[model samples]
Target: MGWVTGVMVYFVVWWTVLFAVLPFGVVPEEAAERESGGWRGTPRSPAIVTKALWTTVVATAVWLVIWYLVNSDWLSFRTGWLAMPA
Candidate 1:
């Protein structure tokens, strides 16, 4: 149960970081257009989504490594959170 809670916490933290960093890469192109007096346009490139997905994958990997290191002695079960004790 404790290990489940810890994993949930780690996931939440990882996602939060992912969102926070996303805008840095995703927003700059628009900001550049606005700064240059160009009309803001939608991101039509599939690369944006691809980059975000890749970033997510990388972030998840990093989070997993850190989590593993911090919880090296703990056992993490695969059951859903609701199945674990509060």
Candidate 2:
């Protein structure tokens, strides 16, 4: 259950950041103006690819931080042990 919760939290955080930063990186003022009209232009694939790459990097960084905190005893919980008792 804890692992599931952690995974959900990580996904939420990563997606939220991705959506928030996406506008800054991908939405030029002119592009937004154009989009506001009924005629929407196709997004550049290269930009989408770059955003995915950045999102992956950010997500991995977040995961590593969470993993370190949990493993270093900085974050403790009352749950069934998944590892051999020390």
| Alpha-carbon TM-score of each model against the true structure | 0.39, 0.53
Report RMSD for candidate 2: 7.1
Full-model lDDT for every candidate: 0.59, 0.65
Evaluated with lDDT, which candidate comes out highest?
Answer: 2
| Model 2, TM vs. native | 0.53
Q: Residue 15: error of model 1 in Å?
A: 2.2
Clashes of each: 0, 0
Q: Candidate 2's residue-wise lDDT over 7-84, tens digit each?
A: 887888689768865764443232445545533444433376677778878887887787776766445553334443
Which of the numbered candidates is closest to the native, going by highest TM-score? 2
- Candidate 1 TM-score, C-alpha based: 0.39
Which parts of model 2 have CA positions greater than 4 angstroms off? 1-3, 27-46, 75-86
| Colliding residue pairs in candidate 2 | none
| Model 1: pairs clashing at backbone N, Cα or C within 3 Å | none
